[model samples]
Target: MFMDLDALSDIIVLKHVGHGLTVVTAGVDRIELAHPLTEICDLEYSGMVTYAAGGSSVEISCKVARARDEGEPSRPEDLLLTCIFTMVALDPVTRKPVAIPRLVCETPDEEYLFQAGAARSLERRTERKTSLLEVAPDDEESALIHRIWLQQLKYRDRSHPLRQPPNVLAMSRTQLATAAIMQPQYRNRHQTMIFGGYHLKQTFELAFCCAASFAHARPTFVSADPCAFRSPVPVGSVLYLTATVVYTDPAVVEDDEAQDKINKDGGDSESPALTRVHVRVDSKVREMEHGTARVTGQFHYTFTVPKDVRVLPNTYEEYMKYMDARRRVRAGAKSHRSLPVAGRDGPNLTE
Candidate 1:
């Protein structure tokens, strides 16, 4: 997904750089790993501006394909990953959103993609109006919260660890974090900024670890929810990433034998049960002069494990994260249904 952003950043720079506007990643619409590579191989990254709207935001579609070792021509069959991103122009001094170049579709196919992107953009806006962050929890979520409280009450024997339910765990126990000092080697071509891809790679690795530790099994990548870059991190800054298993969807395992098989197989074994894990990674940068840290990026990743597990919130803050993650999961499923399927030419528009 960061590769896509890196490629798409060129378009933003070429179009808006001279206008004295600062461009930043507004959000990631979707990212899907269509196929996973089994061996280390070269990759070709390509991207395009799919839709530019309202003279403020633009949507970019990007893909990663396997690079032939013999320098042979690439094919659609080599496609490995696809992603969609949103970028917005901001006033350099005011840091407020500013107008951007309007998109002009030159061909029928371009117009088709434009319309599709516009629809998706609108859908995202609608979803945000009712997101868990904006409103109180619904009846279903309230019931789940109540159930978690009851479970905690029943298993409050902290001194006797074994007395607690084996399948249930506190959200605090699933937290994992790492920090790094941004260096010149990871700087962007301009020599003043750090590459977004570098941050992405580090964040994903920690998120994977958090999911694995929580599930006690290896996890398969599912999808990433919309992540926004709040600010840009300059070179020589300290970057910190924290990953937490905020929520989970427990799988209905048939028996203990099946559960044991899943744990032994690292969650890759073929089984009817699959638990969905939602992990949130928050990226922050330390301000040396101010002796404080500020959030620079926020990412939400989803993965699947083959075992039954539960993440119970132990505080009000954790409860909010859990509910928001649940909402993101539902929104992601809706996006999957609405997206066009990949075909010979590209995403099948006819569908």
Candidate 2:
């Protein structure tokens, strides 16, 4: 059985810097982190620990690692900050506390880099070397796709109805990335992006499962921007959620003529072939009084798949057939939109 958005939303909380809180684990058990810190390493050096209420224990750890400069200080340097949090939820009812599932959060640390003057010295050196390379112009199309995907990951759940009274919580982007990878099709990718609260992760996982089941194709996990918290999810609220593939397209291929043109332009083999996908997520509070039902936020995501995996003639052709069938179904729905209302009050319309 699938969990409703309301039932799942009750146990999860979203915090700033992509941290999530789960209020209940193993059904009817309250869990929380006692100490929250900005940097994971602080937890270790500072001797901090996370605790759970109602006779349960949770352990979390964090660390920061710097990425080496790709070329010179003048070019962009990607730094990785890894946060690892492990939770062992003990069943309050059982008193045995067999290890509940473990949760881990990892991210390429963005917080400290954003701090003023932290990277100023490196930034100055990068400016010089950046001008010397056959400086490739920015690819706006790729950038746009990335931006949209990140925004969808970060801001889609600002108005979650389950978040009534906010609470202190810690969440990590790694968890979201893990959930995305859990989708059948996306398992092969080495990288992924995760955002939002624990409930949000559950919603994404649910949608991913549905999409995988419906399409019978595994998705390719990619990147997520960042999640920002707008409100807090309270404990013991029933959460409901729905996810769907809003748009998908077969991978594109380049003919010999196109390849020749690229060769003439001196482009490298690293040129990217693009495939796109969009996912929509809707969340709400369930198990509430009548008239209190509400929709949280919706997210639209676009994924870019490389041409090698997506554009092979066989793969492209196969995906095209699937897309065609999907389009027909959508068209059939559109045809129904203009029909006359059947009920006395007329079919309720959403505009």
Worst lDDT 10-window in candidate 1: 342-351
Tens-digit lDDT track of model 2 for 1-351 = 012221222222122112222323221111111122234331111111122222333322222222234554321111222211223332335534443232222222222222211233243356436422324323642353344334334333677422211110111100121111122222111122112335445655665564453334464433221122222233334445555444444312123454233334322246644434434455564333443644544433333434312211123322333233233334333532211111111221111
Query: Mind sharing the TM-score for model 2?
Result: 0.29
TM-scores, all candidates, are: 0.80, 0.29
lDDT of 1: 0.72
Q: What is the C-alpha lDDT of each candidate?
A: 0.72, 0.30
- The positional error of residue 131 in candidate 2, measured at the CA in angstroms, is 34
Residue 1 CA displacement from its true place in model 1, Å: 6.9
Instruction: Give candidate 1 misplaced runs (Cα > 4 Å).
Output: 8-23, 40-42, 67-77, 89-98, 157-163, 251-272, 337-351
Instruction: At residue 64, give the lDDT of candidate 1.
Output: 69
In model 2, the Cα lDDT at residue 294 comes to: 47
